[model samples]
Target: MAEANHGKWTYCVDLAREEGRRRTRRRGGFATRAEAAREMKAVLDGELRGVYEDRRTTVASYLREWLAAAKERLAPNTYAGYADCVERDLIPAFGHHRLPDLRPKHIDCWVAAQQDAGRGRVTIYRVVSTLRNALNAAVRSWRLRYNPAKHSVPPKPRAAERTCWTPDEAAAFLRHNAEHYADRLTDLFEVMLGTGMRRGEVLALHWSDVHLMDRKLYVRWTLAAVNNNESLFREPKTEASRAWISLSPRVMAALHRQAALQVAAHPDGRLEGLVFAKPDGLPLRPQWVLDQLRKRTAELGLPKIGLHDLRHTAASIMIAMGIPIAVVSKTLRHTTLAITINLYGHLLKDSADEAVKALAAALDRADAERGASESPLPLAA
Candidate 1:
């Protein structure tokens, strides 16, 4: 650093470059020489560590580049969400900071602001997760010495209490929908109830995937809304999620009606036409499905639930009707049986009681059989 006659300390550094050219980076107007020296030391340390990306680049620009490069690797829906979080929240918070200047405190402050502003845990969690991932990419690329976002902790998301309608309530709602709003919800809701398929899986269903004779259907792809007023058919969620699901007779009958309706609505359309498309032949957006359910539930004066809640209700119905846990787990296409058990453990509480009772009855029967044999045993034995 060199001081002029005015006596304000100035600092300059030869920043290390990842490429051919060394760049001149400078700062000025520090009140004390020690302050300028400290800044100079930090710059030299960062350069020696080979962790500086340019001090000129903002977090927002770097994050956008990182996300663009990451899009091809991330799932369509997942990438879409990451983009949304960055654009809506992360970029706005740290966008102005130079890449090297983004400290852990900045992230900590952002999280605090989010929580204090009444953001939900899940929302905060997603934003934090997205930021962590972006910064992780930066670390891998040698853009930063470490990820500040690793220390960015949002409030832990509490496991949501599953709120679902009982069998009677479900039946009543279906009856109401079929009677009052037949055109909007009945068949789709029935399919979900029967199969317990996820929202994406159900909406992505195609006529060809349905086997009327076998009373089953194959999950092939998911309908995802990745951008503004647009939707795309992407692959199923995971390897486990792509499987044939058994169909109940009610579900089969609904499919039959749906087929007829599909034919009537879009005759001579694509060969693998969507089973649940808008009237204009476009695939239904996930939001549209949610809005329909929300509106219908409000209209019926019933407890409102999302599409996933319907899946949960279906799981309860299956478990309560004596379907095996493993079977239910496979039917729901959970990655692991443990996940299924954890999510629906409350509904399966009776299973433990039933198991104990069953074991006791078996032992009692065995004892009685042994007593009968003892009485029949003669001295010849």
Candidate 2:
């Protein structure tokens, strides 16, 4: 029913209850009676369809509820990221607004404000993504009609180009490590560059997973840091990342050296501990490894590259050696071939040119053969 009260229209309707109890839902402040009636009809329709959303739920409450549910299902690192964005950014921005009252315009204004505040594009993108994801969940649960943040999210930031070493540069760096900084890190760097293993995967490696005689190792765990404060061992990044990786001779050599060093450091240590650990037998911090890499690169007067760049450098070297992209993808343990292509497509330019040239040569030979076969033999007689 719709009524006029104080120059505004109001609508009231009884809500369907599962139990034998009557409940009423009412709304006011529409400019016209028709608008109020339409809204009432829509609410009735939604209730009939079992998708009625309560407008009383604030964004703050909904997000908090959603986060609590998300924590049980999401990975620790992933949940930490979501929690940080929701509590530090999203809730602070629009927590007062009702979930049902959220509009695309509101999301757009927030994105613009973030941009004006000189926030990093990647940071803004991630926070908006968190909002969009939470709102998507609300839409799926019928808590909201639609996700207002869906179309209003900022564009994802492009990955920055990574600096990778050439074969000579890599060789020179390894040699320098061997001569000057000959320690466990020397072997660690050798294993990283040789196998293209991720920092976490390498750090989480266990001696039991390595087979020196067979020249292979299994990737089972990855060490993840939560908020850069605490470390935890988690499953591999993907199922493919858990598969066996064939070790190169250089990698095998590094492992042997690491084994010797481990024996000298801890004669009574068990074999079940981490392959790469500090003196206290705890996993080495990823940040500390990066810091050492920076310090060494600066000392060597080489272009500064992060530890992850060693993985890229390995992929580049393999691609340059005419290795098949599929093989390279498998070697790198990429979940998909497209990922390898996307990351190293620029390096495939020469290979692509060679393929086209070979095709052109074959076509030219076919054309010449066809012309010779069609020529008249009488001229030669």
Candidate 3:
């Protein structure tokens, strides 16, 4: 036993041997030398008896191991995203910090710093969620006694207003698209808006995924761009993402026209795999798509929206038309109806006036029936 006086407490380090050569140093703090020695001895005995093995591993080291095991359970794209989040956002902030010393105050300060660095609430939320889950895994493995993530409160940004183009506005946008982007790009955008397919799903589409005879688009895979270098195909984010979307006549016509144009341009139908590929017949890059959309919107002087806003627009149109929430949820491939409702609940509330009218009509019918019954069934026979 080695005793040292540090700060206000006496520290004792006990050397204990377990099995043949497994040795460990048990450390503890006490007020007096005798008490420190006794506590250290007890901890050493527990260590030898395999009761407590303090995993003195750091947060960074454990995260690497956790990521390795977690990757196997997730899709390739998801794994890549998680890896990016850890490497870019998490490691720089907490990698060197002592895991046991982390506190809620520390997390709050770090989150504020992140916000100061211009990280949006959505990005910060994702980072915090990833960090929390990583720490949670450590807790489950007994590496940690408490999860600091539970104590941290990342700011929640207010939800943005939902804006969807009306039917006439949709037509105007399509007409402008036909006039400006007259090739496969126009068709691809139209298909996305018409079918409510995600951007990745639209990029992952292949000739085989389309069923002209059945007039359906099979959405089973998505194309993800990693590090802006290569595009890879992976399973959709959720189970509900794998579905069949009925193609509208105009959208089907556009796809068919694009197919003919591609066959004519490439001589071999550009059957290089993807339905919406680059001009050189390679997979479309997400950034390139965004660039095109941005330039086109600028040229047309249209309302500027992100690529994802197209998806929101589709969902908004459905909600405005009184589509059932469950159906919209399934169409959007959300994990739950609650998510769909939460995203578009504001729009649904606008229909409340009609709902009140329905209740009033029901009451009127009941009152009319009651009055007839009380009027003495005059000459009913």
Candidate 4:
């Protein structure tokens, strides 16, 4: 053990292996030797648990290494997102800080700084999530003693008041499209508003997946934009999402029309591979859908909503019609009922109110029936 004076007695523990193989830890610049000893004690205690890291590793270096290792196993989109968080947000904010020295307060301060820089809670949530996940991997691999980010509270995403078209509004939008802009994409919107399929899921729809005769559709895959403007076809969001869902009558009718359109467009009489393709049989871009919807709705004086809001419209329509939440969960193919509840449970407000009213009405009716029956029995006796 060696003690040096750098404004105070800074100490180094000589955890030397026999035969002069040296393993040492140094901590410094404390007001008291006792303070240094306390930190030294903590480090010694942690060493027993295989929790010691080379104290020289900075947050930036560790995150870069984590990203390099993780990118191989991650999905293209996921890897891209983590890279952005590490390079653009996390490393910039915390690069110089030692990885193992991070604390909950440091993470909290970073979040506040993010807010000051005009990042939303959702964005902050994602960035912090990336940091936490990286550190978690570090801890498991013995690069980090513990994840201080685990104790940190990232900003909670305020569930923005989800604005969506009502059934009436959706019907009007469809009618407007059919009346004025009866294109291939019109059927796309029709299917989305009816089946509650996501924009990517709908865009990736294949004729093979659509069972017109059975009034069902299979959500086999989805499309994603990754690696600049390039697009990739990927699996459904979750295993639960890869499911077969029933089609409504309107959706089935739209499919029949889409088949006719596809057949007439090509010399081959058969409805081809993609149910919704461009005139030249190219896959329609999601940006085209977004732009068209925005443009058309603006012309028609309808409230502006994205393709995703059409999905919310479908769920809202089902909820308004008194469909069971469990059925909605299955239709949407949420990984769990809790996930379904968390996202769309607010829409069930009317259902809850209706349930309470029904219970009260039943009780009242039962009391009246009992009163009448008791008096009649007395008269009969």
Candidate 5:
């Protein structure tokens, strides 16, 4: 060990391989001789345990490498999100630091800076989570001893309240659609609101999957947009999302109308094409759909909502009609019942109140009957 020109301590070690080949490892930038000695000993111990890691890797390099590998495993949309956070956020903030030199304080300061910069809490949370995930991969690969971002991650932001329309509002919106803009989206919105299918699931629906005679449709695929440009047909969001859904009468009618339009447009009967598509049979752009929805809702003087809100509106309607929560969960195809409950619990308040009222009425009637029976026996005596 020796002092460097930069006024920091440096150390070197030599090792022999099983084949008698020799290798040298050097490290520097320790502030004191004692610190250098401690690091050298730790390195030697790591080498003995066969867990040695190169300390020269920088955050930017490792993060990029991790992202490249992640692309193959993650869904296109998910990978796009991760790539955005890594390139636009993580790289700029922590890129210059050596991977091994990163500490919790560095992450803490960066998070503080982000907060001070007026960034949204959700964006900050996602970016920090990306860092933590990348560092976790490094630790698993033996490139990191511990993840500095592990405990420094910000609390997840609360989900925004969903804007849902009531049944009357939904009907009015549909009526407006039929009167002013009777197009493919009219039937699309009808199907979405009637059956509680996700926007992606409905867009990716193929005519072959629809059993109109049986009033059911299979959800096998979902159309995912990557970077708001390219669309890819991926599997359903979850295994439960791929199951068959029973269609309502109105939804079946909408499908029948859509089929008639498609059949009239394509004399060849494009049964294998998407159930909801453009005149050329290509999938409709999600953003374009949102823009149209906004325009129509504004014209009808309804609350501004997105395509996903149609799904929420369906769920709220079902809950209001006294559908069982489990059935609602199945209809929504949530991965877990808890997810359904967490999302729609607020809507169940009326049902809960009604349930307790019925229970109280039953108990009161039983108590009255018992009191009359005891008093009648005394009167007869």
Candidate 6:
């Protein structure tokens, strides 16, 4: 602070690192020293209030922290996805803007820009949802008046119908697998195709989870990355996810064969080690598996799809083959039958069409039997 001149105040704030080095800082000017002091005090108060957050914290900054905390509570691979959104998409657009200053129109405009920039509707929807949730928390805890992100209408996501592999497509993938990555990864793929287990679930498998004697595999956990420094093994996302999946004879056989291979290769045939480990017996990272899938798809000239679609494809194929929906839902370890029906209901509708035809045929047979059994002479009707 500088001495007063003619009762006018002059003051300066030191914006320096903890080590005592000074750096360029934001400055304000006032007419009186006392007034300057007051202004500085107010600014300092606001900074202290937002310190847990950063000074001049914006929607984007707190969102990053919220995302970090949320990531800590989620599985590793899931957190990686959320972080990607925070870094590459959300922060770039709204990082510096204050929360209170944001308006619905601001969010709407940003959403439009993202759509114009070629981001998928689903991706944009997630970005807005993530921001809305973080700001909602701020409103509850941080003196924020409103959640502007929630005030804006979420951009409509384009309808994304599941595209499962057809029987022929599945056959091609299986044949390719057998030819190239046979015995090891091929068996794993077959198990996924047969049981509709997610990639993470399949990879997270342990010999203990595989109840071969009971013809079921317990889906109790999934593999995920929590952060750069750790991989987390987490329970299935939903209670419904923690169910038993009945396996077919072929699937059981494949798993048995896989177990034997693991025994011969891994020390003590450790059933507790990761189901899918690296050649050197380390846990396989999920991204590496995804990369492998992508490369294989490119080589085979097949349309690129997510590993999750393999689960959907398995369910869809079974539905097409006249498997009951409830069984399929259980096999897929879905939380609700509604979810299974929503995703694969169209397949079920097709099945229903066939069922109706068979029902009609039975009714016609009953009518024929009644007419034939009646005594023609019964009377002088």
lDDT by residue for model 6 over 255-342, one digit each (tens)? 8877788888766756556566777756667676677777777888887877888888898888878889998887777778898888
Q: Kindly list the per-residue Cα lDDT of model 1 for residues 181-203, writing each as its tens digit.
A: 77635899999988899888888
CA-RMSD of model 6: 8.6
lDDT of each: 0.84, 0.89, 0.76, 0.83, 0.89, 0.75
lDDT of 6 at 103: 74
Relative to the true structure, candidate 3 reaches a TM of 0.79
Could you tell me which residue pairs clash in candidate 1? none
Report how far residue 141 has shifted in candidate 3, in Å.
Answer: 0.5
1-381, model 2: which lDDT tens digit per residue?
334356888888999875889989889877788878777887898888767666557999999999999987787889999999999998988999978788999889988988999989999999999999999998898777778998988778989999999999899889999999888899999999999999999999999999888999999999998876799998986898998989888888889888887876776754658889998889998899999988888887888999889999999999999999999999999999999999999999999999999999999999999998896667654
Q: How well is each residue in 1-381 modelled by candidate 4, as lDDT tens digits?
A: 234544575667766466878788676666777766766776776667766665557999999999999877787889999999899988878888988788889889988887898977888899899999999998998777778898675657777767888777788889999999888878899999888999889888999998888898899978786753667778886799899989888899899999998888778687768888778776688888899999888877888898888888888888889999999888888899998788888899989999999999999999999888875545565
Error of 6 at 75 (Å): 4.0
lDDT value, residue 201 of candidate 5: 93
TM-score of 2: 0.87
Q: Estimate, for each residue in 1-381, the C-alpha lDDT of model 3 and write its tens digit.
A: 334555334444545545667555545445556766555555566555544324244667767888999987877676787788788877887877666556667778888998899978888887887888888886777556678988675766777775566667666777888996687788987887888888889989988888877888898788888776778788887787888888889879878887777777776546436788877768888898898877776775677776787888888888888888888888888888899878888778867778999999999999999988885656766
The residue ranges of model 6 lying beyond 4 angstroms of the native Cα positions read 1-57, 68-72, 87-92, 225-230, 267-272, 294-304, 355-381
Q: Kindly report which residue stretches of model 2 are placed more than 4 angstroms away from their true locations once superposed.
A: 1-45, 377-381
TM-scores of the candidates in the order shown: 0.79, 0.87, 0.79, 0.80, 0.87, 0.73
By lDDT, is 1 or 6 better?
1
lDDT (Cα, tens digit) per residue for candidate 5, span 333-355: 89999999999999999989999
Candidate number that wins on TM-score, 1 or 2: 2
Which ten contiguous residues of candidate 1 have the minimum total lDDT? 263-272
Stronger candidate by lDDT (2 vs 5) = 5
- Worst lDDT 10-window in candidate 6: 46-55
lDDT of candidate 5 at residue 313, scale 0 to 100: 97
Q: Model 4, stretches more than 4 Å misplaced?
A: 1-47, 267-270, 372-381
